[model samples]
Target: MIKDHRPYVVKRAWLKFQKFYARHFLRPQLTRLGTGFTFMRPWHVELFGAPIRIGRYATVIATPDKKIRLSVWPAQAGKGHITLGDYCLICPGVRISSAEGITIADNCMIANGAYITDSDWHGIYDRLSFGQAEAVEIGKNVWIGDSAIVCKGVTIGENSIIGAGAIVVESVPANCVAAGNPARVVKRLDPEETFTTRAQFFADPAKLARDFMAWEQAVLQGNTYFGWLRHLLFPAKGD
Candidate 1:
């Protein structure tokens, strides 16, 4: 079988567009996009001066309606850091505030309305609130569900799932699925789930890409339109 460089080429081309836009259209216009992160419509909100390092193939989408509020700590005024590892998918409505530092590792999927904060943001006492808060570290291959809130000083381990509508108050270990208010570990994900199998590879990067291209071509050829027409004409298999 021949090695396909098309995917690599396509990805690099898109990365170029991302870099150009981040420097020219976004960074000067908005806040910071950092290095190697792709920001689509970052103008809607403000990400603090904290080094928002987005790894290769990581995406942060800030929509028109959703705005992310990032807090910059005075102690960290000169230096603050937020690092996201490779292939991390941050959906719309994700907000991260780092008064100290926050690290999210590779292949993590964060759904909509997920908020992560490393600091208390305000001092426990109003006077101390301005002081430096602790840092947060989220390990690799984590999935944070929609509308979940991860509070200050919490570290989520690798291969864990934070259920939708959960509020994380404490640290969670690897290979667990946590849910509910305050977010407790309900189930453990199998160790095998952490490693990608051959089927998964084909289903994700390979087949998914082919399917998308096919869908685009189908639309161009009116295949989808005619298929819908045929479906209306004959309610064949199942209603």
Candidate 2:
């Protein structure tokens, strides 16, 4: 109950199935998707409208309780583009709803329950009308913390960190840490220090895959198929 009851082979099979589901069902919905991407529980990820583009080596994790939704509802025929660059991490409950455009650069990580929007779907006075829509730009290696809301016309600079649960309405400068309801600049990141991005982490994809499988094998050393079934049937306290 403290550990994964499924055997290593079962884990591998589950991963393979997830990948298969992504390729077969999830890929067709995307406007563009590059190779070597992992979408865990791909079915839980909802994609609507286009042009929704996601680049290579992206790791998107979605759960039943926390579904990742990318919805692009263009006001006009030529608008609404949602672009996520290479080596990005999209966690559970991340909803990106774009009426114009939302551009997220490479190596960026969007934490769980984060919401990025480009349009106020409802007007202030006229609740039925869709209000102004502006493009949102997120620079390279930017980290959007859990439950953060990035509103319209916001441009977050490179290597900046948006604090957890912050509501961003204005542009965030590079190499800084922003927090609070309006999300002010609380601290600035060290320009001298090198940032280790997702691009760097996935530099050697083959090696990383090998190491990951090796880790799974080691961690699920004594797990069995029967044990997994037992746990599913009657889960214990730790489980």
Candidate 3:
């Protein structure tokens, strides 16, 4: 029995096209975007308010229904700012809004439905009055779980893990796991323990990308343009 490799080739071609579109169209809109930024569905990622900077090899995944929003609101004293460090991964339904500032350090992985805000948006008593704005800092190698909320004036230390559905209202110490309504330290990670992050994958992204393409070509060696067309029109049973 012959293996059908057309679907893989078609998928690879589509992804390459998306990457090209993202680089040419989306990169220009950003205040500062570093090299090798990959956007999985760039149309669903929204950015507003300037002075936002994202570092090299960052990957952002978004869908039409679960858009990833990064916004900064202007303040009377100082303007809002957002800085995302190298090799960060931001998943779908993640929103980062800043009135003062928000800084996410290198190799941070923000899970789906996470929210990071630096302002309350409005005062409790004074409906018209804007609430206090503060800086929110997320340290290097932090993992923010799904549906977590990191509120104003919060600082999550390096190597800390914010559990799923946690609401972080206070500072979290380094190398610890936090969870619950108001996130607190649940467990501590060993100081000497070493773990891999998204940074490792991006260290030599170009070479890895080339190798991937080469492998794909080898796998789809006998696949023709006609096969790709057929795959597009009438996808396989499992597809």
Clashes of 3: 0
For candidate 3, the TM-score is: 0.89
lDDT of each: 0.70, 0.95, 0.89
What would the TM-scores of all predictions be? 0.70, 0.96, 0.89
lDDT tens digits by residue: candidate 1, 1-239? 12222333344456567567666755553333444455666565565564566666556677888765554443546545677777777788888877777888878888988998776666656865555477788988889999999987789998889999999989999999999998999998887754652224334555666785675444444324444455556546552
Q: Which regions of candidate 2 deviate over 4 angstroms?
A: 236-239
What is the clash tally of candidate 1? 2
Q: Each model's number of backbone clashes?
A: 2, 0, 0
lDDT of 3 by residue, 115-229 (tens): 9999998989987766888899999999999999999999999999999999999999999999999899999999898888888887787798998888877887877878767
* Residue pairs in collision within model 1: 122-129, 123-129
Tell me the tens digit of each residue's lDDT in model 2 across 106-176.
Answer: 99999999999999998899888788899999999999999999999999999999999999999999999
By TM-score, the best candidate is 2
Q: What is the lDDT of residue 86 in candidate 3?
A: 94
TM-score of 2: 0.96
* Top candidate when judged by lDDT against the true structure: 2
